[model samples]
Target: MFRGLSAFPLTPVDEDGVDLTAYAALVARLAGAGVDSIGALGSTGGYAYLTREQRARVAEAAVDAASGTPVMVGIGALRTRDVLALAEDAQNAGAAAVLLAPLTYQPLGDDEVFGLYEDVTHHLSVPLCVYDNPATTHVRFSDELHARIAALPHIGSVKIPGVPTGAEDRVAALRALLPASVALGVSGDWTAVRGLNSGCDVWYSVLGGTFPRTALALTRAAQSGHADHANDLSDALEPLWALFRRHGSLRVMAAAASHLGLTGEVNLPRPLRGLDAEQRREVVAVLDALGLDE
Candidate 1:
C-alpha cells in the first residue's frame, strides 16, 4: 500500500495557526494528481516544530483532505509516551499509518530503538513505517535493527534517507535482510531515482508533494525501465534540489509555494527564517524554468 510516490507535503501555517484551507488544497492537489500515497508531517511537514494539539489538527485535516487516499502521519517525539499519544491521535484522525522515527536528545543504541518500535506497535492498530532519518533524529539504524524492527508485528515498511555513497550496494544489502513483504521507501529528493532503481519499493517524496506531476512523471519513467528519461528528469530537477541542499528543503519549499501563490506566506516556527531575497529570486528562476510558477 505504501508504494509509488508518497508525497510529503509541508504544513502551511501562519501566525494564526495551521492553514487548514491551504493544507487541504495541497492535499487535494496531490490526490488529484494520482500520487500513490499521502504522508503528512514527515520532515518536510515541519512535524518537529508543532505542538501536540497542532499536530493532531494537521493529521485530521490531512486525512479529511486526502479523500480516501492513504494518509500517513509522522509520529516522532523525544519521549516514547509522547510518540504513543501522537500515534493514537493519528489513529483517531483516520490516518492510514504512522511513521515513527527514533527521535532522541542523546544517542540511542539499537536496543533502545527496537524497544521504542516494539512499544508503539503494541499500541497502534494500523501498520507502522520505521522512518530511518538520522539527519533529524540523531540516531542511525543498523541493518540488524532494521531486520529486527521489520520482524515485529504490525511493522509495515521502512523509509530510508538517501544513501550518500554506495547507494546500490547498501540498498541491496538492506533488501536482502528485510522480508519480501516489507516495503522499502526512499526520501532525499536528489537520490530518489537511484534508490528506486536500486530496489526501493516507494519514495517518501517532498518534491512530489509540492509538484506531484513532475515527481510522478520521474517515478513512472524510472519504474518503467526508462533510465535515460528518468535520469533526465532528475537532472532537470537538480536546480531546485540544489536549493534544497543549500537552504534546507522545508524553508525553500514554503518559499516556493508562496511564490507560486499555491499557498500564501508560509510562516515557519520562530527562530527559523525562510529564504532571503537572493534565494527567493533563485527559487523563482528554477520554478519558471520548470514551468511551475504558473
Candidate 2:
C-alpha cells in the first residue's frame, strides 16, 4: 500500500465546511484511475485547519469513496493526546494507514519529536507514515532522528521532503539507516521523478490527487526504470512546477481544482485565499498550453 503512487486530494470546502460530495468525487476519481493509495488528509487536504469532527468525517468519507483502494488519512495535531485521538478516528474510519507530521507551534527538540512519535506509535493499530515536511511542519528530522522513529513499531513509511539533483547518496544513506520494512516515500511534486529514479519506494503526490493519469504515467515510468520517459514527463510540466514554486502548492492546486470545476470557488479555508484573478488566468493559460485543460 505504501509503495507506488499515493495521491493526496484536497478536502473541498466552503462556508458550510467540507463539501463531502466534491471531496468524495476527487477520491473516487483517483481510485478509478488506479492509484496505489488515496491520501485523504495530508497537507494538501488542509488537515491542519479542519476540526477533529470535520477530520473524522473526512476520513470516513474518503474510505467510503475509495472503492476499495487503500486509504491513508493524515492524523496530525498539536498535542500528543489529540494526535492519539485523531489516530483512533482514522482507525475507526477504516484507514489502511495514517500519515503524521510533527505539527507544532513551539520549536521542538529532537527528543521531543521522537517522544511524540514514540507515544503515538505505541497505541496505533494501523501503520504510520512519518511525514518529514520541514517546509510546513518547521520541525526537521535529522537522519539519526529518522532512524530512531523508523525503529518504532507501526512505522511503515517515511515521506521525506524533496530530493535535489544528485541526491542519490543522501537517499542511500537514509535508506541504510531505516529498516527494510519501512518504505522510503518522497513528497514535493516537482522533485518526485528524481526521488523515484533514486530508488524511493513511493511518491506521496499532490499532482496525482487532481491529475492522476499524468502523475501515474510519470510514476510508472520511473518505477519501470524508464528514466528518459520520466524526465521528459516532468520536464513537460515545468510551467506548472514554476507556478507551484511561485505560489505554494496548496494555493495552486486549489486554483486548479476550482478552475476545473472539481470544487467550489471558495474552496480554501479563511485567511488562506485562492489565487487572484490574474494568477488564475495564468494557471488556465498554462493548463491550456500543456493540454491539461481537458
Best by lDDT: 2
TM-score of each: 0.97, 0.99
Q: Please provide, for model 1 over 1-294, each residue's C-alpha lDDT reduced to its tens digit, 9 standing for 90 to 100.
A: 678899998887766778888889999989999899999998888888889999999999999989999999999999999999999999999999999888888888889999999999999899899999888888878899999999998888999988667879988898899888889999899988888877788989989878999899999887888878888999888888898999888888888888877787755765667888888898898888878753
Local lDDT at 101 for model 2: 96
Best of the candidates, TM-score: 2
What tens digits encode model 2's per-residue C-alpha lDDT throughout 113-203?
9999999999988899999999998998999999999999999999998887776987899989999999999988998899999999999
lDDT agreement of model 1 with the native = 0.88
RMSD of each: 1.2, 0.7
Model 1 regions lying over 4 Å from their true place: none
Cα lDDT for residue 235, candidate 2: 94
